[model samples]
Target: MTSKFDHTVYTLRRARLASQLGAQGVAIIPTAPEQQRNRDSNFLYRHDSYFYYLTGFTEPNATLIIFADGRTVLFCQPKDVEREIWDGYRLGPESAVQVLGVTNAYSNVLIDTEMPKFLENIPTLWYPFSIHKGLSVQIDNWLTVVQSKVRSGVSAPHRLNDVCSLIDEMRLIKDSHEIELMRTAGRISANAHIRAMQFCSTNIRNKNQIFEYHLDAELLYEFRRCGSEFPAYSSIVASGSNACVLHYRADKASINDGELVLIDAGCEYSSYAGDITRTFPANGRFSRAQRALYDVVLESQYAAVSSTRSGALFTDPHNAALRVLCKGLLDLGILKADKCGSVDDVIANKDYFPFYMHRTSHWLGMDVHDCGAYSEPNSLAQNSAPSPRVLRTGMVLTIEPGLYIRPSADVPVEYHNMGIRIEDDALVGDSACELLTRDVPVDPIEIENLMN
Candidate 1:
């Protein structure tokens, strides 16, 4: 219901994409194919992010075609009374022209017949490459048809370009509508995290055993209760030693009374994603050692957040977080000075890899790990990594700096098997960044108070 973005927004996006093509160019994009989950049922359908961006159409078996002259055509499912009785309603091709602002509309069954006609005599063709299955073969068949018309003076396209590359540039920057949906999603996800925390503490207080799945259920209830469509990804509800595993899924593992529970979860509201991670004690009180390491990770997140403003390089926040994490590790004796030397030496040698394996942040949008090139285009130099992309306003990214201390003889016993991560969604601004997922508290004291 919140997807009330004006239809003109999609029209403008299509026109902008069309202008990137030459006058005779044709672009085709399809929604995600529905998959059969079992013998009788199908997986929950979700439209393709790229297709939804340009068309705002959610139905399956749909394709959108745009020409260089700003004309748009859509192919969709045809009306069927019998099928409609079983499945839900569909906006068939008849009403698509008026409803979707397309220049023409046709049933998907006409694709093979009509596509080749449009392909004839085109100088360039554009479609998503390496993403859609069987699309390349379909294009080849269409080209074969066009080639057969050579004697009739019809020519096939000479140049083929990946349409996704062109659209990626447009999607990298969020429009006003996308920002609003993301803000709402962030709020919903933050509330979900708070609910999970409260549920964990309540269960412990009631002298009941809390399984990881129990907390996961609480997160899902809050997400849907607050109007989120679904979880952005599989919820990571790791407790105790399970927290040391970065991508662990919520399972039946019982959460012990004094163990720290790390929940990395978020919700998707209107196709946009919110990603937040928080770690707190199951008993609603942080142990002295837990608080120490938690403070270090929180400080690193603060450093990363401070470096997320516009005009900063994409890697600046990562670098800032890395510096703080390395210093914290050194001060905490996680990286021994005898073997790892100073913080700079530890960083230069990547001595912290065992504890912090993943990057500090990633672009967040429609997909949890959204689409965007991290490096500046054509900025690669000899014997060096590509230059990082410059941060810009309207760009959304996650600031998640974490420390995972797996049990080891080299580490202090009290700090063993402790994993702490404090994450929030950050929106880049002119002078600074706005933290979107802070509706939930990150401070240890505040977390304990909320749990109590």
Candidate 2:
């Protein structure tokens, strides 16, 4: 079922690309392939973020081609009654062109034979080779065939380039419609997190409250009830010292009243993703040590979110958050003052990696880690870039800063066995920024009140 937003997204994306390419090339984007999960089972299909961003068509084995002159064509699966019965509904080539407002539409079955004809007069070919290797090969073979068709009197496109950069640059800014969808996605995900918190309050037993799988299942149930088909990624329900593991998915542990639980989860609404992370007391109240660490992480998160604005360097928040984190860690005695020459030297050495690892933010949209360049090197200083890419209005990103210290005899005793992460989705607006996932409480008191 196509929504009103679908057409608007398609038009905006095409317009952005056409404006950049300016009648010099053709951009081809192919949807994801259906993969076998097991013998007969297939994993739930997700569209390629780029393809969906352009056409909003969710069907598999589809390809969208946009000519440099701004003509758009869609190649998709034709309506087959038998196949539809076995699988589900299809947009069909005819309706795809009519409904999606493409210039032309054709069956996928004809692509191998007809692609050459489509490229006959085009001067440049733009396709992504990094993500879709098979599709890249198919394009290479198709280009080979097209080149073969050149009679001694005919001319063929002499330039071929990856369109990933072009499309990625265009996607950096979100349109109002895209922002609205993301807002809805963020709300649903926030509600899911709340549901998990509520579930935690009731299941205070060591086994029940801290069981990683149970918490994961509860969160997923909430997502489904709120109309999200599946989580944007594997939900992390790390509890207690388990939280100390950055990408901890082995959610098997016993909940202790003194420990903290970190939940990093999100929902996928239409292809846009809503990523959020929250850490709170497992037993509904944070202990002194836990609260101290949580406060630092929360402070860093707030500082990072506040730093987000149009025209700011993308790494500004990360650097800003790192400064705050280093001070906090130093105060907590996690990083010995004498071990590093100075705060700047400590951060430069990344000695804090023993606790805090990973960047503080990333592009968030169709993919949890959305496609877009963070930096493009400037020519002047061997490897110096244009101070990282600048944040612009319409771009949505996540501000996530965390600290983890596992219970190990080698680690500092006071900071042992603790983990805290605070993440929120924010949209860079023309003047300021908007927190799309702000509904979920991050403050200690609010989290405690909700749990109680």
Candidate 3:
């Protein structure tokens, strides 16, 4: 399929990377290899994020080589009529130059013979480290080939640098194109959540047995129906106490009428990821206990959302959410003041860890976790202690605040076995953050209305 962004976007990205590399560096980026499922079938192919960021090529067994002089060479599969008949169409090397706006293209079969030439005379080699398996060995082999020509004065790169360090920083700041894609992705995911919620309430009212997989199916169906290529990550469809397990996947367990279901799911649109989490009653209306806990989580999420803005510290949202959560937990008797002290004390002592463990936010983009440094890189250069990264315009993150209360004797009975999380994608702006996933209502009344 054709790329959503104009090919010029990718061409500009390559030019920027080449400018960063200057005259002494050569960077190699290879798309992800297809993994075997069992015998002959392979898992669905997904390209490497870095490679796709630069080239927008989705084919497997492809590699991108970029030089410091703004030139790029792509090694991709050659067209074979027989293979095309069996598997699918191949862009083939010849058409890639014109179609992808790369400097040159060649069949991937020539990589072993051509890589050494690309590395010769370059003082530094840049590639992602520890991400691609066996990539280091491959780079070493190519460098060794260049090393064998020492008598001819051909020098291999002596320094190895992680190209991700540069690209990660670039990816952190969303361009206009990326921002629009993420917004659309968020809307798609939000609609999926709405679909799952409506499906669950309708089935439960009809007296049909509901399983976690049932809701999971609705999410997947809606994602694809809305033109998403894949779910951003594994769909989480936890019901009742199962929600307490942070990474719980949808299982075969039956969802009871009175219990709450937590769905943490999203969709991948044009290489961008949108993540959203919602907790709602399996029945049409929430019980008093469920609503109470849900309100606390929702308030905490609002605090986190308010803390997200340009010029604020990245940790501000977490700190803001913690304050709200601690207070709510104390007020609800989940934590006794005599034991955990005041809300401030609970936060300082981390007494709330048992209830709310994870951070309130995370970067979201091409990958769910995305590629970006959490701490400011320039903070160390200022000769001071390391500091949290400052939020900036064009930065996108997820404000996800959750409370997972397992059964505990010290906690109130009504609060036990409850897990509630409120998450929405936020884009950092000059003075405030814009929530991108509000299409799915977080308000209890609104959710009930939608379900009905």
Candidate 4:
């Protein structure tokens, strides 16, 4: 399928950076390599998020170069009628430059021959090294050539730095186009979750019912039909006690009639990711115990979402969410009153990790676990020391709070084998936060109403 991209926007972005670097260096970005799924079959290609962010091109074996003197070059696959007949289309070097508004373009076959010349006068070269074996070897060869020429007074920049941070900082703020795409992605992902919820309501009627894997497959089908290229990550379709195993990917077990299912799934549109997790009872009605635990998780998630605003500390939402979860656990008799210290002390002790294992929020964008520093000077870490940065507007993140308890004879029996998680994507606005996945229900009553 043809891509929907504004080449002018990418050209402007490259110009913005090239102008900043100013005549001494160049930034180089290479597309990801195609990997073998097995023998004679290749895994579905997904572009590296960083490369996609800068240039919307998705073809493999491609490289982008942004010269400090304000020039952009794209080196890509040459046209081959035979290969195109089998694999599909190729943007070919010449058309890539003309159509994509690149300053110059070349065939990938010429990269090795051409790279040394480009690097000769350049002081610093910015390229992600050691990511792929072939690329790493290529970088080694390039660096070795530069070093060999150094004795003859040829100087290359002595430092190597990853451009991930620079690009990550740029991506933290979403432009109008990016926000719209993410909103669409979130809507589709929310619909997928709703479909699963509705499916569970009907499927669980038969006591001898379906497996979690079947449900996961259904969700993936929904995502694909809705135009997502791939799921943001592996869909977690945890049923019954399996839900307690955070990051559980095995979806083979049959869902019990009365047990709850925690589904954490999302869709990747273009390169941006939309993540949403919803826990609901398989039987279409939450039991008293299930409702209590679900409420706690939902409340904690809501509290965390409320804390996501401009100028807030990155740790604030986590700390706030932790307090809510701990208090709820205590009130529900799942946690003993004096076995730990004060609420803050109990959270500080990390005793809650047995039930709630991950942090409450993370940056969300091009990658599912999107890149960006969550620290600022004088800002405390969620579970550690102070961070080095603060939250700002246009940043998007997930506010997810969960509780998972394995069935144990010694523990609170009423709460045993229950796993509940409520997650929503949010954008930090000027004065408040916008819930991107708000269409997906979270309240126990709301979920039950929708399921029924």
Task: Sort by TM-score, best first.
Answer: 3, 1, 4, 2
If scored against the real structure, what TM-score would every candidate get?
0.97, 0.94, 0.98, 0.94
lDDT, candidate 3, at 266: 97
Clashing residue pairs found in predicted model 3: none
Q: Residue 123 in candidate 2 has what lDDT? A: 81
- Candidate 3: Cα lDDT at 38: 89
Specify the highest-TM-score model's number. Answer: 3
Candidate with better TM-score, 1 vs 2: 1
Clashes of 4: 8
Q: Give the clash count for model 2.
A: 1
Q: What is the C-alpha lDDT of each candidate?
A: 0.91, 0.83, 0.92, 0.82
Q: Which whole-number lDDT from 0 to 100 does residue 20 have in model 3? A: 96
Candidate 3 accuracy as TM-score? 0.98
Clashing pairs in 4: 213-251, 375-388, 375-389, 376-387, 376-388, 376-389, 377-388, 379-387
Clash count of each predicted structure: 0, 1, 0, 8
Angstrom error at residue 14, model 2: 1.7
Give a tens-digit lDDT track for model 2, residues 1-452.
64553486587678678666645678888999888899999999988888888887788999998876678889999999999999999888888867888989999999999887777767888887688858768887887877887884445677777788788876777877778889999999999889888788668733453577778888788888888867899888888778877888836676666577889999988777899999988788888888888888888888888889998888988988998998888887777787765679888898888788799999998889988877753432356544577888888889999998966664567668778899999899776789999789999999999998
Error of 2 at 346 (Å): 2.6
